[model samples]
Target chain A: DAMVIQNPRYQVTQFGKPVTLSCSQTLNHNVMYWYQQKSSQAPKLLFHYYDKDFNNEADTPDNFQSRRPNTSFCFLDIRSPGLGDAAMYLCATSRFGGEEQYFGPGTRLTVT
Target chain B: SQQGEEDPQALSIQEGENATMNCSYKTSINNLQWYRQNSGRGLVHLILIRSNEREKHSGRLRVTLDTSKKSSSLLITASRAADTASYFCATESDFGNEKLTFGTGTRLTIIP
Candidate 1:
């Protein structure tokens, strides 16, 4: 089955340490997205990649960055993890302009 | 700010009973989508209703869209314990962008 996959479902990082979360898809979607979700809250858009172009949300912190090395893989890098940054990071994908998005299982980040 | 807001932040119902949740958005949307998320998990797309469409059904799920009111509703009939999860409404703005703004969500608990 074609689906999105995320590595290291659970991650722990120390304050000010850098951490990276990875997402890969078999769906061959042209758009991939990264979302941050805190407990009991909506998933907030961090950024996304349409093909090779990166689009970051205006309110996204400067400490967050993303890279799409190829069609199937996208990575989210946290330059300096903070306690407030601990949350579930989700990765999703969809075909160009498609309304339905397929999401990965998500990576839970614990920043100490 | 969040574009969509779901009402009845939490709901509890017995198995076999139907569950309904409503969502309101602040902008013109190309389409509205509903997603389900189990506790501490990624989201699963349930249904999508386009601006031109009023209602749609899939399996036991029924979704209604009211463009004039800028609102939508999701009805799940014969709910089961497995259906216990958080339901969210996401809107795709008519601006031709694929980014989705999600609602806070309604936490539904189905009593067995």
Candidate 2:
């Protein structure tokens, strides 16, 4: 089955420490996205890559950043972890202008 | 405000019953989609309804889209315990942007 993969299903980081979450997809979709999901809230789009073009949400905090070096891989880096930044980070991929996106298992980050 | 708003933040039902979730959006959309997420897991695409299409069905899942009202609904028949999850509605805006804006979501619990 075509799948998206995320590493370090659970992550713990000290306050102000920088941490990185990684994702890879076998589906070979052209667009990759990173979302932050807190409990009882909608998954908020942090940024995405359409091929090599990086599109960040206007409200996304400066601490969040992404890198999509190639079609198969993408990474989310938290420049400084805060308690508010602790949430499940999801990675999704889809072909450009497609109806559905395939998501990975997710990385749960805990900022202490 | 979120592009889509799913009513009834939570639902509890017995197995074999049907589950219905409604989503209302604020703007014209190219398509609407449903997705499911298990606790601590990423979303899985369930079904999609394009703006031009009124309704679509797949197996036990049925989705209806009303472009005029900018609302969509998802019906899951013969629900099971395994179906307990958070269900979300996502909308692709009229401009053909690939990113899907998701709703707050409905948490469904199927008691077996």
Candidate 3:
């Protein structure tokens, strides 16, 4: 049962405060991705780490950053939380260039 | 901008009935995939259909792709109450390492 795991299924943060969401995978997949999904909207690609190389989406705001310090662990950091930033943050992993992806239980962030 | 759009934002049907969801994408895709998400949880990979493959099936799930329309459909037969969830379609472009672009999801409720 290799699985992707996300910590703190629910998070509450105050506006202008910093928050961090963590994802770890036991599948040991080569590629890890972060997506932000707002209510009834598409899950927007934030960025991904292929091994250790971090690739950010062109439209991703500068306020958002990701760190993949190791193969199985990744973190998404919001430097300054905003109300609009509240959404379900999903973590997904797959073998490089593979068509199938496995997703972790998402972290739902609530910015107050 | 959302690269994919899923039809029938929400659907409610009786258990044992067939459920179908459709997705249309804007660009050339290397592959199209379907995923399921339970309430407030992560997405579970359902199926993947390559750009060249016209149809694929797994268990009670059937996926069809039409490159001309840049569209794909997922059909689930003999669906149960457990099938009530959000289903989303994601596309991988012909670009590097197959980064996925996901669509707005379809919320399916199976009435028991």
Q: Which candidate gets the maximum DockQ versus the true structure?
A: 1
In candidate 3, residue A8 scores what lDDT?
Answer: 82
Candidate 1 regions with alpha-carbon error over 4 angstroms: none
Residue B64 in candidate 2, Cα distance off native in Å: 0.8
lDDT of 1 by residue, B1-112 (tens): 7999998999999999999999999989999999999998899999999999999999999999999999999999999999999999999999977799999999999999
Which candidate would rank higher by lDDT, 1 or 3?
1
Q: What are the root-mean-square deviations of the candidates from the true structure over C-alphas?
A: 0.7, 0.9, 1.2
Q: What CAPRI-style quality would you assign to candidate 2?
A: medium
lDDT of 3 by residue, B1-112 (tens): 6778998899999999999999999988889999998888888999999899999999999999999999999999999999999999999888745588889889999999
- Clashes (backbone N, CA, C under 3 Å), per candidate, total 0, 0, 0
Q: Estimate, for each residue in A1-112, the C-alpha lDDT of model 3 and write its tens digit.
A: 8999998899999999999999999998999999998886767889998898888999999999999999989999999999999999999999875468899989999999
Q: Sorted by lDDT, highest first, which candidate order results?
A: 1, 2, 3
Better of 1 and 3 by TM-score: 1
Deviating ranges (above 4 Å) for candidate 2: none
For candidate 2, write residues A57-87 as lDDT tens digits: 9999999989998999999999999999999
DockQ of candidate 2 relative to the true structure: 0.79
Q: If ranked by DockQ, best first, what sequence of candidates would result? A: 1, 2, 3
